[model samples]
Each structure stands twice: as C-alpha cells, then as structure tokens.
Target: MTVKDRIVEIIAEQAVLDVSDVTMDSTLEDLGIDSLGLVESIFAIEEAFDIQVPFNANDPTESDFDISSVASIIKAVEDLVKAQS
Candidate 1:
C-alpha cells in the first residue's frame, strides 16, 4: 500500500472509524481521535513504515510536533520515506 493508504488504514483502525470518513484534510479531533488514540495511531504508523516519527508521545503538543491533520501526517510520512530512500 502507498503511504497515504497505510496512514488512512492506521487512523481507521486506531480511531475505529471507516476509511471513507477520513480524508487528507480531516483533523484528528474531527475523526474522534483522542490523545490516547493519536499515540496509538502514531505507534501503528511507526511499525507499519518501520520508521520513527519525530514526536514525543508524552507531550504531543510540545514543539507543535503532533500531527493534527491527515494531510500533515501524510506529508511527514512522505518526508520520512524520502529521507530513508
């Protein structure tokens, strides 16, 4: 699957929402993803892509590193993928 597809699946599984409900512009809060859910989703994404997300789980808001929107998350993942390549 593509990075975007993987991200959508991770969010869907973690947030317990349908994939159709999530879009590039959908925010985590819009998808009903709480703090714990966001952490879980990040972990899932890390595992799926075998890459570390540059955010502190303990303080998601610190340094504005937390990904609030699907588009931002996808962009971050794409950057990581590109860096690895």
Candidate 2:
C-alpha cells in the first residue's frame, strides 16, 4: 500500500474506525483519538516507514511536525520518506 493508504489505516485503527471513515480533513480530535492514541499512531507510522517523527509527547505544539490533519500528516510523511530516499 502507498504511504498515504498505510497512514489512513493506522489512524483509523487508532481511532477505532473503518478506513473509509478516515478522510484527509479528519483530525485526531475529530476521530476521538486522545493523546495516547496520537502517540501510538505516530509510533506506528514511524515503524511502518522506518523514519523518525519529530513529535514531542509532552508538548505536541512544540514539535516541528504538523499533526493538524490527515492530509498534513500524509504530506509530512511523504516528505520525510522522500528526504530519506
């Protein structure tokens, strides 16, 4: 699956929803995912792509990575993967 597809799956799993329920505009809060779920989702994404995510658990707003929406997250991950390549 593509990176975007895999990310949607991860986020869906974390939110306890079907993949179809996740959209590019969906935010973690919109999906009812808490901070723990967010962290878990981030970990899963990092593992899936084998890339480190620059996220701060204590203060997510302080992190450089954007977690505002699924679309933004996808873009960030794609950029990271491209940078790695």
Candidate 3:
C-alpha cells in the first residue's frame, strides 16, 4: 500500500473510526483522538514503518505531534518511509 493508504489505515485503526470517516483534511481532534490515542498512534506509526520520530517540544507543530490533518500525517509517514528506503 502507499504511504497515504498506510496512514489512513493507521488513523482508522488507532482512532477506532471507519476507514471512510478519514479524510485528507480531517484532524485528530475531529476524529475523537485523545492524548493517549495520539501517543498510541505515534507508536503504531513508528512500529509500522520501523522509524523513530524525533520529538521537539519547542515546536508543537512538528509533524510527529502535529497530526492536525490526515494530509500532514501522510506526509510525515511518507518522509519516514523515504528516509528508510
């Protein structure tokens, strides 16, 4: 599957939402993802792609934590997948 597909799958699985509920602009908050869910999703992403996402508290909008939209999440995963390749 493509990175976007994988991201959507992750969001669906982690957020406990239907695949159809996920959209490119859908935010985690919109999907009812709490802090714990967010952390779980991050861990799932890390394990799925076998990449460690660096943390940066100074930048709350960093890709790893800034899962404001499905597009952004997909971009982050794509970057990690590319890096590993």
Model 1, stretches more than 4 Å misplaced? 61-66
Question: What's the lDDT of the predicted structure labeled candidate 3?
Answer: 0.79
Instruction: In candidate 2, list every pair of residues with a backbone clash.
Output: none
User: Tens-digit lDDT track for model 2 on 24-54?
Assistant: 9988999999998999999999999999999
Clashing residue pairs in all predictions, respectively, total 0, 0, 0
- TM-score per model over all chains: 0.88, 0.96, 0.84
lDDT of the candidates, in the order given: 0.84, 0.94, 0.79
Cand. 2 TM to true fold = 0.96
Error of 2 at 22 (Å): 0.3
Using lDDT as the measure, the top candidate is 2
What's the true lDDT of residue 30 in model 2? 99
> Is 1 or 3 the stronger prediction by lDDT?
1
- By lDDT, highest first, what's the ranking? 2, 1, 3
Candidate 3 lDDT tens digits, 1-85: 8778887898899888898999999988899887778778878888888888764535647536456688987887787778889
Return the lDDT, model 2, position 54.
Answer: 95
